[model samples]
Target: MQSWLDVDPTSDFSIYNLPFGVFETRDRAPRAGIAIGDYIVDLAVLAERRLLPLPDHAPHREEDLQRALNRPTLNDFIALSKSVTGAVRLCVQQLLMASSRDAHPPEVWAHALVRQRDARMLMPLRVPNYTDFYSSLHHATNVGAMFRDPKTPLLPNWRHLPVAYHGRASSIVVSGAPIRRPRGQIKRDDDPTPTFGPTLALDFELEMAFVIGKASPLGRPITTSEAEQYIFGLLLFNDWSARDIQKWEYQPLGPFLGKNFASTISPWIVTLEALDPFRVPMPSQEPPPLPYLRASGNQSFDIHLAVDLIAPSGLTLTVCRSNFRHMYWTMSQQLAHHTVNGCNVEVGDLMASGTLSGPTPESYGSMLELTWNGRNPLRLPDGSTRTFLEDGDAVALRGWAERDGMRVGFGEARAQILPALDGEA
Candidate 1:
């Protein structure tokens, strides 16, 4: 996996790494690109040049990648097996390596390829469905302690299963998109009546999302061992919530509009193969999971994740710091539980590891837990107190895995809050 290019061995773009994404230039439509150094290797141009050794039976064409990116679905591209992805990566690496005798000159590829700074990156895949799981034991326990007694920090079934709820895919946007303040019904604990208006308690949940690359038949279940083959990559996810709205509506069923507003994800999808170096042992369970959810080997990655809050005045504070290893249930276990009932999962479906909090107060993932459900306010650098997000405030999430001499990053996911709309009673 040697490259003649002067790519830093410490960089994310080693010859062994090929992460996928979608980008649009000022003139072109959204299309697939592979990260190589500071530039983006445009897949459409490479396919047109016949540089990639794609199988004859493969359904993808140069045009398909471009069109699929513009549409709302990434199923066609994700369905490609690992063999095809490997071939594409090898070809791109050879084309970029200067020492390869058969390689084309840099000038030839430069005209079609674009610098990452000049391109507008979009969500790598069009997700048809999304499910968020409460997989972090520390997050669940900390939150439970605030609302319930400390002795009953965890629900009885928390250890036995991966608790999850369906999420809205249409509201999921790529990083940098503005999150509009959602209007909802809010009831005060001491007030006699409820009021309808913009949400006052907005918060962000730091998590990771796994994209499904392969589909299962409608009536078939994917086993734990087979789940890895179906996974494509990982991205940083911010599951924004309206806490005040949620407190009023969450009763018999789970969240509704409170959780449906907007969720932001990082543009780049760091492939699972790229993260092999960071694999670590999962935490031991209090009560073991059922047979269907059990998995062997190191099931989680040691990804260092953090969240930063920036006010409109440019003051930034590092609020939460944690690792992906805190998750109680692994991605394989979540996938196994998802299909235990024979519910089919399609390509491009997203599974989010909800709120990755750790064991300490400094590592809490959301404002709800950090502020103790608004009982205490988070003091800011400007001497202001915040129970929830305010207009013009921005939230950013960053994650990476560093091992040996290489560092693989998921880039960053960021969003700024807009003032609530006017009129409309």
Candidate 2:
């Protein structure tokens, strides 16, 4: 996987991992690009110059390839079959590996490559809808134990189907966006009535979301076996939560304003083909799932996930260490469950794995569980204790997969919390 373009060995954007993203350069308009080390190879430029060749194995027409690559968002490109996306990636790999033989001119690299520092990363797709799922058994149990009875942590229906809530697509922002503490109504334990104010318990939920590639009709159901055909790739997701607001509001119905304020995701979408080498067998389901939810292939990715909290005082703590494999429900099952009842899914839609917590206390995903609802405060390196995130606190969610010296990564989903607006309270 060596490339003429020098890629840092430790870089997330290695030659083997050419993840796609959207960026805007100072001189050029916003367009789709692929990461190769510290520079971004503009797909639009390559397509315009006829530099991207269709792989021999794939029979895609050049016109179709050009149309998809030149788009501002990756929605059109990913909306094509997975074979098309794989072909484009293969073509890029071959183009980069052409150093031994002078197949392409030097000017090709000069015109296609853009320094990452000079490019402003934008949301890779226009998300039509977002569904955040409670797929992690450990996370569900931890939250249930903390809030509900410890003896009966998991709900009765939790093991039967993948539980999820339709999220606010408009609030889903890309990495580096500042998240403001949301203002919501809260009823304290001591107070009889609820009052509206900025939330006191702001937290970050470590997660990863899969992007939908293919679109389905309104009444069509996507089976578990057919789910991967609609999936494009994975990205790190941070679903910020207002604990106080959620506790007071969530009752008969699920999350509303409490969980809808903001959600941050990494810029690059790491394709499934790039992660194929790291696939693991899906966790065995107890009380066998319904026929539609049963999967045949290896559906889980062995990606390592970590969360770091950096205080305003410049000290940082790795608050949680978890893995994508900890998810009880696989992406395929989630998608199948989502559409089993005739719900439609469109290209660029996001489905997030809710808080991927593991079996240990150190693996808890959110601040509510990590600090145990302020009863157990985390001691920071700056000699300060934190029950939840403070103003100016920056949280970074990082993830990667390394197997046999090959590494694929989802760059950090990072955001700094800003104080609530003066008049919001």
Candidate 3:
């Protein structure tokens, strides 16, 4: 957990922590690098140096490893067993750990690794399928209250198990991509005619998405015991929504256009192993779940998550704050349920935990819930009020786990709204 690199120990990127990512420089194509302070430990160059030692069971050929790194997907790389992952992390740490002055100088650790500013990061993995689950009781209840009576906040089945719907993977974009305003149908209760135009009720859902690295056969259900084996890591996700369109179409089927327009995810996949120390007890269930969804032990992660809204005029507001521990259902349960019907899950499939909201208003995960379905407008620093997102407004999601002198982080997922298309009505 130490590196020879001359990085501040307190920095998010440290030699002890080499989070892998895909990046490209002015002169180089996309390749893998380990974040170390202000620089990226170029894995392609490290491979050329034979500095990367593989675990005994690692897949053969540096070329395969390089190919996996260069490809848009991180699935192949993550499918490598824990032993292989550990070996690579250990070697990278040794190469960057501060060296003894007599043994070697700090500059000795510096190699062809490029500075962060000189490199551009790409999506860490190419997602094959995406599924978003409604796992947060607080968020679900708060949202349900807006449409249903407060006394009957949750649907009968909501407390029994996790509710999820498959989402479009093709529309998932990397952070920094512009989320073009989506167009859809909207009808007010009093309006005689429905209107089709850019969304007026655009918003962001703050949640964590896990990347699947291993596949399960068509008929086999992934047992809770084996769920972690299939998981690679987690990233912050912004499941952007168009509430207006959603309300009109989300009757017999769940969300379609409202939830699928443009979802955003952070670039780095913070490995599950790195987050092991931050594990917490899963929230208690009201009525016990079915046997397939039950785990003998507690399961959850203690990750702090937050969302910020920035106006076009440079004003920023900390909109929401919550923790992952608030989830009513575990990821293992969700995965088990997903495949209970003989559905095959492959590497690169992304599973998102729906808005991780807590109990208080300040912990609301989305503007829709916080504003009570647009009844209460959120006041911004620039003296503007907003019940929903406005064009040109940007939303950013961030998450981290802090404990025992270690900090594991998922970088921000940010997107700005563009004006809706004109003359569609």
List model 1 lDDT by residue over 1-425, tens digit each. 56555567656556556678888898867777888667787876767665676666766665654444344334566676665665666677677666683467666676656888899988777788999999999889987887787889988889999999999999999999999999988999998988999999999999999999888899788888899998988999999999999988888798888999899999888888888888999788767778888786898999999999999998999999999999989999999899989999988899999999998988999999889888889999889988899999999999978877677887789999999899766
TM-score of each: 0.93, 0.97, 0.94
Across 148-203, the per-residue lDDT of candidate 3 in tens digits comes to 88889899999887899999999998888989889988887899987888888998
Alpha-carbon deviation at 204 in model 2, angstroms: 0.3
**Using TM-score as the measure, what is the rank order of every candidate, best first?**
2, 3, 1
Model 2: residue 11 alpha-carbon error in angstroms: 1.1
Stretches > 4 Å off in candidate 3: 8-10, 99-111, 423-425
lDDT of 1 at 128: 88
lDDT of 2 at 408: 88
Q: Is candidate 1 or candidate 2 better by lDDT?
A: 2
lDDT of 3 at 337: 86
Model 1 segments more than 4 A misplaced: 1-16, 55-73
TM for candidate 1 is 0.93
Candidate 2 per-residue lDDT, tens place, 1-425, comes to: 68877777888887678999999987988888889889998888888888777666765677877777767788888876777787778778778873643777778778889999999999999999999999999999988898888999999999999999999999999999999999989999999999999999999999999999999999999998888888999999999999999999999798998899999999999999899999999998899988889885689999999999998877889999999999999999999999999999999999999999999999999999888899999998777899989999999999999888788888899999999987854
